[model samples]
Each structure stands twice: as structure tokens, then as C-alpha cells.
Target: MPRIKTILMAGTALASVLVLTPSPAAAQSTTKPKAEEQQEAETSTAKADRETLLDTITISATMINEAVFDSLSATSYVGDKDLERIQANTPADIFKTTPGVGASMNGDDPATAINIRGLQQYGRVVVTLDGARQDYWRVGHGSGSFYIEPDLLKAVTVIRGPVSNAYGSGGIGGLVAFETKDAGDFLNADEQYAISEKIAYESNGEGFTTSTTAAIRPHQAFDIIGNVNWRDRDAYEDGHGDEVRWTGEEVTSGYGKATFRPAQGHEIKLGAIIQRYEDYVTGSSGSTSATLSRYDADTINNTYTAKYTYFDPDDRLLDYAFTAYHNKTKAEQTQVWPTSSIGNFRYYDVRTTGISGHNSSRFDWMGLAHTLTYGGDYYYLEGESSASHFGQGEAQAYGGFLQWMGHYSSWLELIAAIRYDGYHLDGETKGTTTTPPEDESLDGDQVSPRFTVGVTPFTGFQLFGGYSEGYRAPGLQDVFRGSGAHDTADGYIPNFGLKPEVAKSWEGGVNLKYDGILTESDILRGKFTGFYTKVYDYIETDFTITPRMTDNIGTARLQGVEAELIYDLGWGFINLTGALIDAELIDTDNPKYKGQPLENAPLDKFSATVGFRAFEDQLIFGGQYLAVGEVKRTQRSSGTNPGQVDGPAQYSDAFELVNLFANWIVSENLKIDLAVENLFDVAYTDPQSAWSYTSDVEQGKGRTFKIGVTTRFGG
Candidate 1:
């Protein structure tokens, strides 16, 4: 497809960067045929000035979300001083600093995955925020999205590996982009118009998170920004508060952005986003004990965006962009089933709806730079169950992709991409029949590929490597489930006949930046990486009862190595990270489960930190340790049916946390800050939850403590 003719020649050179920016007032009113050569240029113009800042600092991670770092893959960035000290809801703290990537949630929940070089979620990798294509979580009764609301963010970029045809076929496992917050960056450089606020607290649980931001910018062309976030929670005790694990929750979110440059590298942007949530649960997966089973779950979301860009006034030879988007996700859950004669009670309702549309593009050649992206997606799902034995489902599909990035300058880099997908289904169940639901239509096609290489050879040392191929597509109640007793697969898994799961990966690392590199004066930062991945098919969970879903198991392998070290210590900073993974399950044909050990794969994990600072940068003190090691469910070959064996193989755990924070400027505009989370009193459980063989292990979050304060009004 010549990559769609290289994005149609990058949209005709982005309309020649809008005809050279209106010719700068027609070159100063076409005058000066030599008025004494402008009096010798006014004596060399009182000196000199040469300027270039990549047209106001190259936005969108480099025009249209370019992904080709680490040579076609492995890209990770999380700015804003690490979002002012972690607790970043989703994007798992910036994809764990990228590099062969691997992430886990279920511990504070965020609905995320990217495991490249090790292949995860859908098999290869694909994540997007500004350009759409997101499941956000709802894939198999999980209904995720991690409660999305991180103060409307400002930065987060990830491009792990294997980006199938550039971005298609569920990305086969590579792509992440959540870049928001732009309204001329809230002006105020003597131009006036500004306001900002933040309130936060952490110490295991018991929550209060508040945020506000505003920017108006009278004119340097035009700018407007608004952001808001609020979260409230009560329920703790695994470390304190007595005993309440992961409880009660409420969240409200909103953001608006507008920017118009009229001329000068031209631009136009409009946006809107909203989210509302109410939650309460006591161990999902059909609760048992820990009461509070009076469940509550609701999510409402809306996003609308339109974007355009053009640039090139010597601005790196090229720049181009076009964007359009719409998003909607409505989720609901309420339950209290389990009774017989004594108080007879029953009620279970589940609902989901999604609608999506999106598009993307970018390029710069001759210096060797190319990027081409394409899009198309649609969905409609319906459900209502209370053991009525009825159903309805529909999901349409269309997809396309092409990616190419080659730098050939500044020490090598190369990347390649491919993608194509098609899905369809429509159905009914004869007016809630006693037993008559198994009608369907199916379709499919997939192709994903990737390759990358990044090398610096010297200077702070940089060396990278990558390989890719991935796929995932099997939803809609896992292809028409039916029958009864929680019908899983209910019968026919031929909803267009499943098939689309493949993964192959690789990873190599070496990077040691500099600017402080230890001692040289204090400010230091360090990173270390190691990886391994092997897999095939691997998509378990099945019981064929009627529609009891989850399939594609047979082969699997996952190896791991992780490390991290950092020190900013201008006054205080310290961090250390570690991980180890070794998974199994191969050629499972089921027979009680071939070779087991794949329930939530975890071998070892660790985290440590130390911090202190006073006055100067304000007060802050910290100590933390999160640990996990030894876990087994054994009997692999594509697990799930391991039963009888005396249960539990091994489990080791640890958690020690102590924290306190304060920031008191108290002058030149006043400021205040405070924080404390799980200062000790540990009780943890987040090995990525298999729910402990279905549903049981819930204990986590205790010693609760949280407080936040902020003040600022107009400026």
C-alpha cells in the first residue's frame, strides 16, 4: 500500500507548512530596495539573534505521536517531575520506565497492559489515548479503565514493541499515548491569566485527591485550558482503620482545552472529556464473606476532540497532523444474588456500551524520517441478566495500518509496521426463551509485524534491540455463550470462528545517562534492564457451559529481569526497583490442565525507597518497601483445571511503608502541602490477582492516612 502512499505524501507536505506562515507580513511590506541598504542595517541591528526551538518545542511527542525510539520500539517517558510523586492511577507509573516493558494492575487498579518483548494483552501491544482505539478494560468481566482521572495529565508516552502494521490487529502488543494538557501551557509569562491547585494524600488508603487548573492567555494568538479532578474514599484496615480492604469510592473528572494560533506554524484544537464514577465492592468474582456485598459500580465517559497541525519554517524540514475523535463508555453493575426461601432475594444487572472513531498521520524525509498511520473502529454491546436465560450482542469492525520510521542519523534507528482487521456479529434469543440462544455471524483477518534497533554506541552508553509480531480478538461474550448455570461458551465458539493470537519477542538493554551520573555534585539518575519472552496462542479461561468464556490456550513462556536506581537529591530523592518472572504452560489440550503455573504469573518483585528534605525545598520524608516472592499454582500446559493437589505451592510477601510530606512556601503567593500513607501496618495482595484461583484473596491496603491542602486564586 506504499503505506498509503506515505500518508498521501504526508498530506501534501502538510500543505507546505501553511504556505510559509503568511509570508511574515509579506517580508516586512515589500520595501527596502536598498535605502542606503537600510543605513547599513541599523548598525548590525544592535547585535544579533538566531532562533529555533523546534517551533515551540515539538508537541505530541514529536508531531502526530511518532513512535520509533530504541530503533522502531521501546519508548517511554513520564514527565512533570514524575507527576509530583507517583500515585498515577493508570499508565502504571509511566509504563515502568519502558524498555522491553511489563506492567501489572489489580493493585490500585488502572486497567493497563503492554508487556512487549514478553507479549501481553491481546498478544502484541497497542494503546492510545488522543487517537482512540482503547478497550480501557471490559474485556472478560473485568470492566477496567482504572478509574481514569489523573488530573487530566500532561505527559505519558510509550511505544514498547511489535506494533503490527504500525497500529492494527489489537497492536499485537505495543503502543501507548496519553498526552493531554495544552492551552498554551497556561500562559502567564507576563501575559497574565493563571490558576493552579492540587490536594493529595497517601498512606495505604483512605483517600482525598483534588486538582484544579486554569489558563486563559489573552493573546499571543489564543489559548484556554481547564482541568478538574476529585476522588473520595473511605474504608481501610489491613494496616489500620481496623479492617476494611479497598473500599468505598467516588470520582468526578472534567477537562476542556482550546488553542488557536491563527497563523505562525498554524494550529487549531478543541477538546472535552468527562468521567463520573461510584464504586463499592468486597472482592469481585461473585463475592463471598467480607460482607459489603451490597455492590455498586457505575462509569460514564465522553470525549470529543478535533486537532490539526502544520509546520516547517526551517522547523526540522517537516511537520503535519490531522485528528478527529469521539468516545463513549457506559458501564453499570449492581448485585445481591444468593438466597433460597429464607428471605428470597435476587438481582443482577450488567451493561456495557462503546462507540469509537479516530484517525492519525506524520512525516519528514531526506534526513530519513517517515511515519504513516491509519484507522477505523466500531462497537455496540448489550446485556441484561438475572438468570433469565436471554441475550443480545453486536460488534462491527474495520481496521488498517502502516508504519515506517528510519532516522539513519545520530547513530542509527529503524522501525517497521503493519496491520489489518475485520470483525462482525449480530444476534437474538427469542423473547427470553427457556433455552434458545445460539445464533451468530463471524469474520476475521489479522497481520502484525515489527522490528527495531537503537544504538548510541558511546556517551552515557545506549544500546537497544527488539523484535515483534502479535494479535487478540475474541470478545462479544467470547463468541455467543449460552445454555445455563452461568453458561460459558454456552456452546458455539464459532462466532465467526475464533483465531487470532500469536506472539514472538526479544529484548536487549544498556543505558546509563549522565548529567550527574553519581557524586559529580549530587543530582544522579540510573537505570538497568534485562528481558525474555516466549509464547504461542496463550489465551486461557474456558468452561463451555453455555457461554462460559475465554479460549486459545496451548503454549506459553515468560522470562524476566528488572532493575532500577535513581537519585535526584537536590535535597531529597531515592528509588530502587526490582522484579523477576518465570512463567509456564505449554501445548495445553486440557485434561485437568497440561502443565499449569500460569494463573497470575509472579516469581519475585521488590521496591525500596528513601527520602528526606526540609526547608529549602520544603519538608518531605519517606521510606517504603514492597515485596513479593514465591508463588505457585503448578500443573501447566495451558492451565485452569488444576484441581486437587492440596492447593497452594508457595507464597512469600512483604510490605513496609512510612511516609510524611510537607511543602510550605508561605510567601510570594503562599503554598501548602501535606501527605502520609500507610506509615506502617502492612497487609498487601496484588500479585496481579487471579483472584486467588477464581475468587478469594482480597486483603490489601491498610494503615490508612491522607490529607491535602492547596490555595491560589486568580492571577
Candidate 2:
């Protein structure tokens, strides 16, 4: 066990060092201010040009949004135009085409899990929606993001490694934030009252996908947006297209948003969201049409938010953002119990309300550019779970964060961030608190810090190094899961006391850009980057094989690497990306199978994609390929994984697949698109539970297709 754990830690450390290094230009941007610092951006923000691989995107790689790149250890951006090109139904779809990115089903569920640096799902990677921290812990999906309609999004930025201080905790890998539509540039001029709408429908036969969005910005001060979605799929098939018999899901959602800027340097936004998912599940082996799955759950997520922002006097570099919101998540799940007569059930109702405020100030100190950001947040969540026993859990978390950025010219930059968070949980089980010896109240606090330096010597060339620490507070289930839910352990049980897990990671990488690099005639633009991260308290869970009780087996170590590359030649574009992760339990201090791969961590995974566009951008085409490495599972005292760890460790052998898609212009007012997933159908099982031994996971959708169209009236 010790040896295996050591390898996991060592592998991760090495990966962190091997990720692409930073460049000279990035270093300068961090430490110094340029002469034309507040100059109008001429880097191409044209809406009619249709942004492609050749365009450069400016991001808040540091505390303040800037035009500089290569100032951070790992980060990637997807623009509005790019989102349209993908014709995606969900946010997860975009990850599929991004380099060094991975997206898979959490199970046979609608909540598709996303991974970066091989660490994701749960709250490992912080996800912010329009700057609001969205915790994935409300149960279903169990990640940082919920089901947000894709069309309403304007951009998605991924800080692929632990290099920022924008989170309170659980940013072990990095962070991904989704920014909804904001039309500052789109409606900046009086004559710019034009509308861009999209309506798309897609179906691979595995199910049907459809969505429509309406956005209007009659003036720069206000933008109104709304979206709707519907999906349905019958039982899916295997790689051979033969019906797998009994796997299906149905979902529908609607949303609305409004942004208002009544005065200069100030803005306010409000939004409403609602979604419900229903599953008509049929078990794997076709047992009684619906009795097979140990997990048959239906969930709903409803949210509302109001936000305000203040820009500096010049709106040139300084900004402050504040937001407050409320969200509710509820679910009911059926568990197949041991006794035929006794049916087991699990239900949870969770409500969360919180407020967050961030203030960032940017200025030029002497010849150097300086930006400082600080913020704090508070959230109270009330939840209840029921089974053989019902338990109510209330947890409140509060924290503050700070970040400082120093630029030494456009070639070098530095940043430091720190955050402290405290959590308290007070609650009791339904019947006898004394039976489980309920302590009644638990309190803990964690501190996380990050440091990064970036250097950029030339345009599009960057090098960066970063150090960061992250942690996750124990969830209600981790410390309170009962015996009836257990399958492989000694009758299910729960531990009232559990500690938070932590990780300290460091990464150094280089970023390269190719635009007008090879020849003046070349229109291709490309970027390549690599990174690594290491965690100390890589949290893990244990279950008894016979009784099915969950246990926290202390802490472990985890490490992984990530890489992405893309190229565009006007005529076509190509992208390649991959991830490698290694994890194991350390100091198990137990005799039950000492050395084994940590549950749910795949040793290696990667993907490849290519896209083409016809003359005048009237036609578009693309395809994708993916790979999932084999995994090793440990024997179980207990686990939700139906297959014992010893069994094949369920080698979800790596497989290859292809996807094809296209878009055609119908007229000035309308357009059409066609997308096919799994063009060359490949049989593959994606890992789901953190406890699953065999990884008898969700199967990839076989041959799905979608057709969609959009039309618009005068703005």
C-alpha cells in the first residue's frame, strides 16, 4: 500500500513539472505596464467576421481582465461564435472539442461529468456561473455546475490547473467558469441594433435534442435573453447498434435573463432558471423492464440570481463585482434492496442561499501594471436524507479571498492569492441520536493559497509556474451513509466524524502560439500548453462488501498532466488533447488490500478532433475521437460498485470513436445544421461512482443525430 501510494504522489509531481512551461511575453505583462495601456482594442472584436482559430482572445488571466496571455499556469477560452459552431445542447459538449479535456456521463444519468488534469466531478474544479460559485454537491451531478442551457452562454473559460485564488476550496485541479450573455460590445453603437439567434435540433437516435434562444440588445445599457430546451431518448444500443435493451432519459428546461446598466461604471443583472429531469430507466440485464439499476433517480434544479457590478472610472482596467442568489436541488432515488419484500429508498431536499462580493483594482505602479482583487462569501445549506433512517443536515460555509498581480512589462508577471474558509454542520438523525452517538455539532476550517509567475517573450509565446493548495469539506453522505445502502460491506453503517481532505500542488508550463508564424500567407493560428498538479489529502471513501457501509480511509495522494493543441488554416482546423492521472491510498494503516488504484481515477485518457469550413464560411464540418484508459479496482469491504474490486477491476478498455457534423446557410434570415455522434460507433463504459470497483459505468451514446435551424426578425 505504501509503495503504491508513493508512486501516485510521485507520478503527480512529475506531471506538474512536465506541463508546458511559461513564456517571456507573459512574464513581462505581469510586471510592467505598456505605453498604450488603455488604447482601444484592435485585436478583432468584430461580430460579423465570425471568430476562428486565428483570432486572439483577451481574458482575465490575472485578477483584472487584460489583453495579455501566458500570464497564468493553465487557462483556455471559448468564444460565442465558437459555441455556435459546435451546435451543442449542453455545456459538456464544448469540453469534448477542447484540447486536453474530457467529458463523460456520471452514470447513465443526464448529468455529464467533466474532467481536466484528470481531476473533476464533485467540487474539485470550481465552476462559476456569471461569477456566482455553483457547488455541484446538491446531489445529482455532484459537480460545480448544473444543467445550464448552452445557447444562453457567451463564453466558457477554464483555468485548467490550480493557479488561481478565486475559489474558497475544492479547486484541486483548477476552475471552469461559465459566463452568460453580456452584450457590451454587441450593442455599443446606435446602429448595432441587430440580433443573432440560434435554433438547433439534434438526435443520434439514442435520444432527441432540441433548443432555441432569443436575445435582444436594443441598446448597450440593457440586454434581454431567454432559452428553452427539450430532450428524449429511447433505450440505447451497443457498439454494434444492437439494442442494449432498457436505458433512457427525458429532460426539459426554460430560462430567462436581463442585464441593465443605468449609469456609467455600474451595472445590474437578474435571472431566473428552472429545470426538471425524469428517467424512464430500464436496468442493464433487461430484468423486469425496470428493476435492474441499483440507482433510479429523478432530480430537479431551480435557481434565481441578482448581481451588480462596478467598473473603474476609466473602465480601462479596474472592476468590482458582487452577487447574491438562491438555489434548490431535490431528488428521489430507488435502491434495489437485498430482500425482495423490502424496498429501499433515498430522498434528499437541499436549499442553498448565499452572497458573494469581489473587488478588484487595477493600476500602473511606475512602469509596472498592478492589479489587486479581494472578496468574501457566505452560504447556508439545509438538507435532509431518508432511508432506513432519516437525517437532517445543516451546513454553513463562509470564507474570504485575496489576490495580487504584479506585471513587469508585457513579458513577465506574478500573482499571489490566499483564501480561508470555515464550515459548521449541526444536525441529528431521525430516530436515535445516541444510537450512532451523534455529536450534534462539528466545526472545521481550511486555508488555501496559490502563487504563479508568467513570462511572455514574444507575441503568443508564454511560460508560467504556479503553486496552490485546495481542500474539500466532508459531505453529509461521506460521514452519515447507513447500512441498508451497502451492498459489498458488512451491513451498512455510518461514521459521524470525518475530516476534510487537502492537496498542495505546483505546476510549470509553456504556451506557444502560431499565427503568421510560418508565412505571411498562412491564416492558421494555434496554441499548445501542458500542466501538472499534486494533491496531499486526495479524499477517498471505503465501503464494506457485505454490509455496504462507507468509510473515510484517511488521505491519499494524486497527480496528473494535461495538454492541448489546436490549428486553423482558414480551410480547416485540427485539435489534439490528452490527460494522465494516478492516485492511491496512502498510510492505509489496514490489512484489506494495501496496494490498488484509487477508485474512479483512470490512468490515462485523451481525444482528437478536426473541423472544416467551406467557402465564405457558408458551410461548416467537423469530427471527434476519444480514448479512455483501463482502470484497476481494489477488493471491497464495501462499495456501491456492484462488481467486486477483484473482478477485472472492470477494465473499461480504451476505445476509439468518430463524430461528424455540418452547417449550411439557408438564407440571410435562417440557417441549418446536422450533427452525428459516434459516427463509427465504439462500445465504451464511462466511470461513474467514486466507489465503483468494476467501473461497470455508463455506456457511450451510439450513433445520435441532430438537425436544427434559426431565424430572426428586426432587432
| lDDT tens readout by residue for model 1, 283-375 | 343234443233355666666677777665455534555566655655554544333222322332323333332333445668876555444
Each model's TM-score?
Answer: 0.29, 0.81
Q: After superposition, how far is residue 697 of candidate 1 from its true place, in Å?
A: 13
lDDT of each model, Cα atoms only? 0.50, 0.59
Candidate 2 has a TM-score of 0.81
1-715, model 2: which lDDT tens digit per residue?
A: 2333343344344334323333233344443355444221222222114233334454453445542234465666777766766766556678764544555443245554556655665466666666655554433222223555565577888776555445445566567777766545344344334454554444443455566656677667878777677777666665666564335667787677888999887889998777777753222322332334445668787778899988856764557777888877776777643346235666767677888778877788778887888888888877676644333577787888888888887788888888887888776532345554444667789878878888887766577777777766665555554534334434445555667667677677766554432322223223334444445444444542334444555445555555655545455666656556666565665545345666445436556667887755688788776655655555543335643544434454455567777777867667787777777767665553232222233355566667777664444
Off by over 4 Å in 1: 1-123, 127-170, 173-177, 184-192, 203-216, 220-684, 689-699, 703-712
Q: Worst lDDT window (10 residues) for model 1?
A: 46-55
Clashes of each: 45, 78
Error of 1 at 512 (Å): 51
